[model samples]
Target: MSDAAPLRIPLRPLARILHAREKGENPDAIERENLRLRHEEMRDRARVRAEGRILVLGAVFTLAFLTIGVKMWMVAESEPAEPRTSFAGAGIVAQRGDIVDRQGRVLATNLDTYALYAHPHQMVEPERAAEELVEIFPDLDQERLLKDFTGSRRFVWIRRKISPEQRQAVHDMGEPGLLFGPREMRLYPNGAIAAHVLGGAGYGEEGVAAAEIKGTAGVERAFDDYLTDPANGGKPLELSLDLTVQAAAEEVLYGGMRLMNAKGATSILMDAHTGEIISLVSLPDFDPNDRPNPPTEGHPDDSPLFNRAVQGVYELGSTLKIFAAAQALDLGIVGTDTMVDIRGPIRWGRHTIKDFHWYGKELSVADIIIKSSNIGTARLAEGIGINLQKQFLANLGLFEATPVELSEAPSGAPLIQKNWSELTTMTVSFGHGMSISPLHLAAAYATIANDGKRVRPTLLRQTGPQDGPQVISAAAARQSQRLLRQVVTEGTASFADIDFYSIAGKTGTADKPKPTGGYYNDKTISTFASMFPAHDPQYVLIVTLDEAVETSGDEPRRTAGWTAVPVAAELVTRIGPLLGLRPEIAPVPLADITLTSN
Candidate 1:
């Protein structure tokens, strides 16, 4: 670098200074003036440098302000959102509680996974990404996926959830646009088991990082708020179902449905006293893990999602007969020994009531029930009078839907005749003229098994009896229990009577009514409402078969005794021990033993 040039200064002629000195005049003023000029030059240079530094600092400040202003504008124009997993201040809940059986077995739970989303503009290989994704999930259409990947969409959802393997597969494609959002999805570990009770869950709120899961039906839907409540601290919702019992029941029911060639079937095993359901099975069933959409074009029953036990109402046939006899006995209008005239075809206008078989001219009230004499039951209903009969049925909870903890419970409200004529009274005595769900029948039978205490059925585990309203005298309930025992031992339900287990119940076979007309002679809804050890009942099981026919005989028998009874017998044989209901009528043999401590 070159050095700065020296500042120009006016110089007095050396001659003049020298001449002044030589004339003996002092030249000190000339020397002092030169020194002052040099000082002035140094001050001017410092001022210019200071001004230059000030200007540079001002430019730097301006640039910083401009950069900040642009950034603020961009941020103001962008959309605002919160992270998906955090909904604390938001009204919606993000996490869901687990559902478990009474035995603490998980029925439904959550799985940590990733949600696949896309930023189309950031894609490096849109076609390859679409091809690979379609390969990973055949359900995806390649063309649609490719279009979505290459289109103007800045963000698009690829899949609601992806397994780790799938996420890795997509990650391997090296596409910058394909991204994963962390989320939890509903998972049913025991596939298709207790499908009806669990109902199902589906996605609610959607985001790239997280998603919301909400119950769509069944207990999941019934307890939606409770399951999602933050105050619950994620405690599992325990149900009345025993997983082992439920699995056994489903297997038996499914096999029975197939063997009987029935269209569908349902079974409910409930605690006679506590009203807690041990196992409720409805088949054909679906896996809640991948729930099917509700059918839009057929009968609701056509859908596997339909909960038959809680939703399907049928003329439960002679299961309703027990209610009449108990009511009559409770009212003191009859005794077990009282004789009832079982005359043929008791006429009531256009319709006539008759027993499935002739019981002669007269049969004792005990025999009336033992033989399942519909005529006798109808006569008892007539004697009970319409108002008292209605009151009695309502007290037994047959008039309303069960208060069971399920979303479908309310829809099971019994179908009652609007007119409720005398004929209606007679038919209803034998489980006709009114339609009720099998669950209702189970509860009614539970009343008898529970010694006449009207119980409100529930899906939650209970510690003891419901101790609901007393609908009938304990004596009447005992008498009814004896009659039901006699039915199994000596009448239509003889097929189910096991000497060791001591089964008791009534057989019901009702002709299915046609959509356009009265009834179909061939198609019948057969049911068996039974309790174990009639002498001292513990549980009431109601098993119903839809259009079941046992064809091993010369003719296709469609009675509950032929179909529902045998299935129930098998179930009792299988699950009775699980319920701690051992078949050994004899007491456990004692053995010699010694006590020791480790």
Candidate 2:
């Protein structure tokens, strides 16, 4: 009813037309219907494609925003960059490797210190600043500093290696000319503990550009390249040293030296089998941290800088009698109980060899060792002859400088007798007419301890068994150990006997030879060379005191038995437990163990 025109087509006619189009009976009507259907299908496909593109655009936008958001979050979580320090003006930036003990304890390291330099022209109040600085550093030469400040000099070193507190103080004072630069100061945490071994580093050529430090002596000099190598990158160079044992030995030796008022002292503790040095102390030691300036007037021959253990050459007195007796026994020249006639002093040229403690007209080799009979021992060496005696000492590594890993060797060649005469053989047997370092004597003793194997002394740790040659038969060494034990149990080195440990050793008291001629009777080099748990020695020690005076004690005496022996006893007592050796309250006597001939 609402239509403008009435519905004209009948349902039957429309249905007829659609049927004809499907059947293609009416050509025009079929083409029009097919065209319309195709157009509608194309429109629907286009709409689907447009919708897919829109979805893709939305995803791209989301991903872009997400990436930006994540980057912002990461930036927020990160730390702020530090302002880079400009070391452009700094002269020196020393970065040396660290030196550590066997246990990784830092022995030597670099400290970040500062050095002060002055630009005289830039200074505001030259006089006032100098006075203030002098007050702050009392050791500074006020006169020299004042002169430097007032002078027209452009650059001058006010101080090298200033402390942090001092730097802050100077900064507070607001000194204009005083500018601080970064520096590395060589620091020794243990002070004078291993001073001789560590030596020291001193500033090399000084200038305004780069500050350099050079190793002048000791291990510092010996291992300079390794320490300063950039590839090492401050990595620790480990040494074969035990701080506790070293400290104990030093304490005992120092105490003894003080008690005896000795000029100087030297002590060494080494592994008997490996020769790895555990401790090497030379008393009157200067602090490597604060090395004393070289003397301008006199030679530093007697200074603390001298490493006496490996450097000092001396006639090692009656201790050499042990070697002489060993030579006699090892060469089948004599046995432990072989009788030696000691009727009187043995005459060889002008020198007459005499024993301080004579036993009798005839004494066995064991009794001669116990009584420290010089005449009897000399006759034993005389029977061995000059060539055999020399060869035996040579085999023990005593005819030359000891193969120790120290710079002391080149400067301290062993003073061997040039003329190996009959007189030389006799005197050398009683520990006279030749000179060697305490290290040489120690190695000889170690040979007697290590089943007759003589290992070279070493400062470096051994990763494997040290290569060495046997100097004497194991039987001879065992016999020698028994003889040495007798000397400690019943003879001159009785003072060195520690109740818990089986200590075996010999004492040497030699007159110090004068620079002008013969020997100084007043001054004696007292030495004690020993091995502990003597039956199977693990450690060997050598202690020496130069020009020691028995100034105090209930019964004061300057002999090795009185001075160096007590030091050895004290050391062995304290360090035995540290070395995992339990105390034996009741020790076995040397006489109980008999040496049967092989």
Candidate 3:
């Protein structure tokens, strides 16, 4: 690969110069010609290099211009598409975490769906399209649809969410103006089952392509950030609710409500050890799939949307009597056999605390609870004093709301007397001066059932017992449990006595008050708070009925003993086995049968 070297000729070589000088007319002329030729050759080489560089630069410029022109032509001639708008910050997250029961059954989940909209200007027949759409969705008004379609507006929303069948119907209409935007909707497959617990979700920050699913109530609202968080990678939120147990409890409660002729009812089944809510039902419940709007007038609680189990606070009547007894015993102010005078009406400054029936002049502390004597309990609580009463109730989570995983919990704060006088204390001892939710009663009873470790109710599943403060000694709780057992056996809650379940509970019947300040004689809030397998309890069940009356007797009766207690008994009989509870059957007598070895 060697190349030949170019010949080197000097512009004014000595041989040429000398020969030219010998034969030429002037030596200067020959030197001038050679120098001129060298200059010309330099100019020609510079022109050739400049031409090459200009060709490369021209090609680059031409290619760039050609590409831009082609892109402009393509965009101009092609059909227009909806422009996608991008924001500067984080976008709306369309996916939400699934809500499942503890057993992994889906309670709430997302469904891939579409939203219907229209470009009014693009429609071939606006009137026809409106008519057809109205037929597809009867809720849509034909006049409104026609007005929007024929109006000057470019776009109109037909429906935020449409089923696949509806989408197909709209597509068959052959209306080019109509369109569907992809969407992910919240779907509760079980309809109304566990509706209050799952709450409901709604659209937020909507767009043509997708919509945000935001929790509106219940646990969905409580755990909104957790459910919609993208970092969790769609891990399901597992609740302690047992789907089978919940369904069973609801059926039994609904039947009981109808049979008892109650206007409304609520039931709560909670774990004694872990404070987990297994099944919380508020009757006259709405499906999360079709959640109703809150009322604007009258009593908002009268609406089906109200969550009575957590948000409805009322005087829980004699159900609260156990707290007075338990606190008195824990403070060493009273014992099981100690006799106390429960004489006539306990009068204090214009208010009188009276018993439902006269027991005697004096009754034992244990009999005070079993017989549910208002005067006896007032006498017992008087020994505990006012400050001690307030502290003990606060310790049992009665001064405030139950911290269950529901957004409505904060609204259920117990109504305590601000001006707590001695009259307030005595009347409250009989469960009249204060109002509390069923959830509060369940938690307090759960504390007693959990041996006074002070369980705070939760809706999440747990692996071990809660680490609550020891509000009272286990000995004191055991004595309270014994008294509650006696209530079911020989007291007002005798209807709750089931041999197999060994139920222990207390009944509460408070007269519903008028809005103007007096109490109605006919209306009562009947409640039964109970725990099963009493010897070694594992759960607490609280059932409350608003304005319930039992007509099974000769005359109509509005008492927890007749209405709420039987409902609780039926609920236990139904869900007991489903909760993996075995009946505590009594052993057969020795003389009745002979045992044979296998």
Candidate 4:
């Protein structure tokens, strides 16, 4: 309204002028619209991009959570591992095997037990704890316990092999530092029944000494390595011993020792065919459970722990005469019908060999064995010569120890070392001056019973073929058996003759030599070596007593017939039925097998 258009213009020019003005005024509006449209387009694209990112993140999180859950489940479903509970105490002894008798009876067994230990550092009121322990275990040393408790030790064994009641009492006390460890203890149930054979146990149920019972004597010492092996825990060891037969033998031996007022006695039974030791008994044996504690002043007689059957050696008198006679016959120097002059004593060097019963004239070999004539034996030995006698004795296993699962001294002295003069030979022929163990006598008689096959004796049950050397000819052994049978039937060992069972045996009574020099006439060793079912022998029994005195009121002198022979007879009577040997009389020989002097 204020300004007037100057010039007269065409319509087109005017419109153009108006359009230019409109374009100038509205330039900001067009730029604002373009900016708003561009902003709206960017917002839509950003929303889609944000939504896509959120979806991708959620998928990734879900996958990772699933993977972790699967892994966790897998880890939780596995099998559980075994707990470790091995022996980790001070000594750490592994468990051992079981010891069983012939009939599978448990002789020795291991029992699980608990031992109490203390961690002294963790203990509260150590002195009080010690006092409490002493109260529960009166035998425990209180002073020692207090000292051990107060000492600077991480661990200390309070007591071992604790009973269940003891363990419960300790736990109820709620004493800190107390710990329990599982242990095994060896136990002998039969007590003293077969103590000598089974032996005893040590602390923690281990085998430890000798007849001293520390794994020192008998089968305990012999089989210690096997019994203690940790790999064979709970396995049983079988012996060839028959407990019934052993009890019978022990009864007889104990009776004889008591009857004769003998210092000590020993007896053994062996299978003649297999050489299995069925029974072995030595009087004055100790209980395996209450083994003597190193021979203190408390125990003096406990020194007899030595096994007499395998360890003791004695001058086995007339019993050896059978071997001498067999030697003469085997060497062809004498026969059953051979005759020898036995008028009086025969003098050789400083020693004079005398006959107990002097036959005024000549006597046959059969008469010699029946009468137990010393002069007749000397005559026969003289004919055989010393070398031949020595050789024959060696073959009979007299020169060496009988092979058994035991420690023993060898039989017979060194023949070469002993002065072998004519007097030595003569006296030895009648079973004097030469010494051997009871086991040796048993083995030799077994040879006679087995028809000359000298099978070695064994404690272990035989599982394989025989491995012993033959010793004598069948004919020679038969002759010896015949003579021995006659000795029991009509000679000195008549007491050993059983009514139902044919008996073959020899009687021996010799003076035990004094430590100084000659034999002690007052002290005598009596022995009886025997076999049953004489015609077909099965078992051999030997009984021996040292320093026997006759108190039976029958005989003043302690002879084999009175002491050892009676014991052998009793043993045979009791054990025969147990061994399945029927009491039937053996038939007489087809030919009269008699012994003759040489």
Determine which window of 10 residues in candidate 1 has minimal summed lDDT: 82-91
lDDT of 2 by residue, 1-598 (tens): 7868554433235666778778878656555766677688779989999999999999999999999999999989997663322246543435678888777888888888788889999999988888899888999988898899889898888888789999999998897888987777889999899889888998874555445666778888888777776655567788888878888888888998888889899998888888888889998889988999766665344788888888888998988998888888888989998999998787766767777865779899998888888888888987899788888889988888776767667777888778789888888887888899998888888888898887788887677556588888888899999999999999989887777788999999999888878888689999999998987888888999998878567855778988889888988988888778888778569989888998
The superposed Cα distance between candidate 4 and the true structure at residue 279, in angstroms, equals 0.8
| Candidate order, lDDT descending | 3, 1, 2, 4
Per-residue CA lDDT of candidate 3, range 1-598, in tens? Answer: 2587566456677887789778866767777888888888889989999999999999999999999999999999998763322345557778889999989999999999999999999999999999999899999999999999999989999999999999999999999999999999999999999888888999978999989889999999999988887667679999999999999999999999999999999999999999999999998999899899989898867898899999989999999999999988898988999999999887776767788898979999989989889999888778988888998889999998788889999999999989997777888887889999999999999999989899999899899999899999999999999999999999999998976799999999999988788899999999999987788889999999999999977999998999999999999999999999888889999899988999
Per-model C-alpha RMSD: 10.6, 13.5, 8.5, 13.9
TM-score of each: 0.83, 0.80, 0.88, 0.74
Ranking by TM-score: 3, 1, 2, 4
Which is better, 2 or 4, measured by lDDT?
2
Off by over 4 Å in 3: 1-88, 594-598
Q: How many angstroms is residue 496 displaced in model 2 relative to the true structure, after the best TM-score fit?
A: 2.2
Q: What is the Cα root-mean-square deviation between model 2 and the actual structure?
A: 13.5
Q: Which ten residues in a row have the lowest lDDT in candidate 4?
A: 205-214
Q: Of the pair 2 and 3, which is ahead by TM-score? A: 3
**171-274: candidate 1 lDDT, tens digit per residue:** 88888888888889999999999999999998887766667788999999999888887677789999999999999999999999999999999999998999
Better of 1 and 4 by TM-score: 1
* Residue ranges of candidate 4 with Cα displaced over 4 Å: 1-93, 116-180, 203-214, 229-235, 294-302, 408-417, 463-467, 515-517, 585-598
How does residue 163 of candidate 3 score in lDDT? 95
lDDT of each: 0.88, 0.84, 0.91, 0.77
Candidate 1: Cα lDDT at 593: 52
Candidate 2 runs further than 4 Å off:
1-93, 205-210, 296-301, 551-556, 587-598
